[model samples]
Target chain A: MNVIDHVRDMAAAGLHSNVRIISSLLLTMSTNNPELFSPSQKYQLLVYHADAIFHDKEYRNAACKYNMALQQKKVLSKTTKVRPSSTGGTTSALQAQNLPSEIEVKYKIAECYTILKLDKDAISVLEGIPSRQRTPKINMMLANLYRKAGQERSAVTSYKEVLRQCPLALDAIIGLLSLSVKGAEVASMTMDVIQSIPNLDWLSVWIKAHAFTHGGDNQRCGTWKHFGI
Target chain B: MNVIDHVRDMAAAGLHSNVRIISSLLLTMSTNNPELFSPSQKYQLLVYHADAIFHDKEYRNAACKYNMALQQKKVLSKTTKVRPSSTGGTTSALQAQNLPSEIEVKYKIAECYTILKLDKDAISVLEGIPSRQRTPKINMMLANLYRKAGQERSAVTSYKEVLRQCPLALDAIIGLLSLSVKGAEVASMTMDVIQSIPNLDWLSVWIKAHAFTHGGDNQRCGTWKHFGI
Candidate 1:
C-alpha cells in the first residue's frame, strides 16, 4: 500500500500517536511528487498532523498545524474560486471554501491559549468572533474562560447568553445557579433546564449539593431529593 | 511577615506560575536558614513548592518535591511520636506513630506516580494496599487507573469492590457498569445503580453516556442515547 493508505490505516486503528511519523513520510514522499495531493488531501494531511500533535500533548504544535491547514485551504479556495453550494456565498469565500470556519478556528485558538493558561490571549481570540456567529458552544466556552480568569460577572453574562441560545446548556445554567443570585432568577432558570434537558439528573444532584452547601431553601433541596434528580 | 510568609501567601493565592522566582527565593531562604523550619513545616512548604512545580509544567520537579515531602513526613513522624488529637488515631502505638494510615500514604504515593504517568509504579503502590483496609475512594481511583492501563477486568473488579463497600459510590457504580459484560449484566447493573443512587437522573445520564459507549448499544447514541439505555 501507498503512504496515504498506511496513514489512513493508522488513523482508522486509533493510533493517533503515530501521525507525526506518517506526516514526515508523506512530506518526504510529496517532495518528490509535489502534485501527488490536491488541496483537500494536503489539508487532510495537516489535520492528521494536528491530531498527532494534540494527542502528544504539544498544543502549540497542534495549533500551528491547524493554522497551516486553514491557510492551505484558503489558498485552495482562492485558486479554485469554488463556491460552496450552501450559504449562497453569504460567507466569505475564504471561510466557505476552508476546512473549518473562521469562528471555529478562533475558538480553537482560544482553546490552545486556555490550555497554555494564557487567559488574556484566550479571551482576546474569543472576543474577535463576531457577535452573530457566537453560538451556544462558543458562549459556553467563553463563560468558562471568564470563570477561569476570575471575572465571575462577565462569566454570568456569557453563560446567560449560552442559555438564551440553547436553553439546555447544563454547564452554563448550573454555573449561573452556583453564583450568589436572586431567588426568582435561579428558580426560573433551574426549572427551565429541568424541562429542557431530557436526562439531566446527575447535573441537578450536583447543583443540589452546591445549594445545600450555600443554604438554599429546604423546599428546593427537598424537590431534588424527592425527584431522585 | 518574613520572606517565607510572602512566598506562602503567594502559594495560598494560587499564583503558582512563577516557579522560577519561587524556587529561587526558596533556595536562597533555605540556604540562609537551613534549620529555620520544623520538619513538618518544611514538609508542608515542600508540598507547596511541589504544587508550584506541577503548575509550571515541571513534572520532574514536582515529582522530586512530592518524594521529598513523603520522605520528610516519614522522618518527622519517627522523631515526633506524639499522637495528635486533631485526627482520629488507633490506640496502637505503632499505627499512631505514623502521620496517617497506610492507605492515606499509599494514596499520596499513587497520586505522585499518576502525575508522572508511571502507571506501573502507580499500580504497584495502589495494589500494595491490603484488601481489607482499602476504602471506597482509593478503590475508585484504582479502578480508574486500571481502566487507563486498559486492564478492563481489573478495573471492573476494583469498581465492584468500591460499590460493595459503598453502594452510593456513584462514580464507582458508573465505572463498574461501564466495564461489565453487555446484555443482561449491564442492564441489571444499570437498574441496580438507578435504584440505589440518590441522584438517579444524573447517575443515569453519566452511565448511559459512558457505559453505553463501551456496550455499543445502538439505541443509545449521541453521547448516551445509543443503547436505548
Candidate 2:
C-alpha cells in the first residue's frame, strides 16, 4: 500500500500517535534527507519512545528502536555520504554524525561490553585506548571494572592514576581517600589530603575514625573527640 | 617539633619535593583545621596518597589515613559544633556537617562495600535510594549487581527500567533494543526516530542500529544500512 493508505489504515486501526505517524514519515523522508534529524529528537524517538514501549512491556518494539539507532551510528562512523535536504536550501553536509571520535567510540564499546557483562571484553576495549589519551573518565571506568572483577590491586592502580591524571578528580580522590582512611592509616598521605583541602579535614578524620573502629584501632577511634574534629 | 622544624628535618632526610612539604604541612594542618579542607581536595589526598601507601603494600599507613578521614566526616556529620579557624575568625565548618545529599553518596557507599567484597551490603545501600532520584548511573550499577548475582530476570528488569526512566538513556535502551530488532521486528525504530526529528535522521538510525548490533541481532542489524545513516 502507498504511505498514505498505510497512514489511513494505521489511523483507522488506532495506531496514530504522532510518534507512529512521524516514524512512518521518517521512513519516506529517509530516501531524501537521511541526515536531517537531530540527536535529541532521534534520541527521543529511538531511545525515549523505545523506552516507553519497553516500559509498557513491548520489548519487541523497544528492541527495534535501539537496533535502528545503532545501525545509524555505524553508518555515520564508517561511511561518508552526500544526501539531499528537505528544505530548498542547498544540502550542506550534515556533520551531526552519530559516529563519535575513535576514543569516544572505544569508550562506548567498552561500556557496551561492560553492560553485556562481558568484563573481559570491556577491559579489552578499554585497554585499547592509548594510555596518554585515557581520560580520567576512562580511568574511573577502569577502576570500576577492576573493582567489579575483584582485581583490587589493579583497581587501586587505576584509582591512583585517576588522581594523577586529574588531581582534582573528586570522585577518584574520594574513592582513594575512603579506602585509606577506612583502613585506619590516618597518618598516611590520605591525611595530607584532608589537611590540604581544609574543609574536609573533619570528614577525613571522621572516616579515619570509622576506619579505626573497623580496623580494631579503638585507641584512635575513641580519641576522635579529643582531636576536636 | 614545630611544623617548620619538621619540614626542615624532612628536607635534610632527602624528602624535599614540594609534594612532601605539602603533604607534611597538610598532615599538620589536618590536625588543627579539620574543617579547613574542601571535599574534593580531601577526597583527592585520600585517593592519591593513601592509594600509594596501600599499594606500596603499606596497609598499616593506609589504614591510618582512612581512619582519620572517616573520623573527620563523622564529627562533621554527627556533631553540631563549629570548628575554629586558623586565622582566629569565626568557626568555619569545612567538613560535611550533614550527610551527603546527592545520589553519588549511595554509589560511593556501594563502592566501599564492593571494595570490601560485601556485595549484599552494597546492594542494600543502593536499594535505599528512591527510584526517582536514582540516576542512569545507579541503574548501571544495579544492572551490574543483578547481572553478577545471576538474577537474569532482575537484571533485565533493571536494564529495562533504565530505559523507561530515560527513553533517551541510550545505554539501557540499546541493551533492550537489540533484543527486539534482531530481525524480530520490522525495521528498527530508526525510521520513526528520524521522522520525529527530521533534521537529524541519521542520528536516530545510528543509535538504534548500534543498539541492535549490541543486542546481537545480526539480521535486523543490516536494515540500518538501508537508511544509510
Enumerate the candidates' DockQ scores in order: 0.01, 0.03
lDDT accuracy of residue B32 in candidate 2: 73
Candidate 2 chain A, poorest ten consecutive residues by summed lDDT? A10-19
Cα lDDT, model 2, residue B24? 42
True contacts kept of each: 0.00, 0.00
> What does candidate 1's lDDT look like per residue over B1-229, in tens digits?
3334444554553434432344444554555677766565566567666777765667766667667777887877775566464344444345334223335656766766887889888899789888888866577678889998899999988877765644334455556656664433434554654575332334455555655666676566576442233
The interface root-mean-square deviation of each model, in the order shown, is 19.9, 18.2
Where does candidate 2 stray beyond 4 Å? A1-229, B1-25, B28-71, B81-125, B128-132, B153-157, B177-196, B199-229
Tell me the deviation in Å of residue B81 in model 2.
Answer: 8.6
Angstrom error at residue A29, model 2? 15
How many angstroms is residue B187 displaced in model 1 relative to the true structure, after the best TM-score fit? 47
lDDT accuracy of residue B154 in candidate 2: 64
RMSD of each: 22.3, 16.0
lDDT by residue for model 1 over A173-206, one digit each (tens)? 4567666544346545656545554333443454
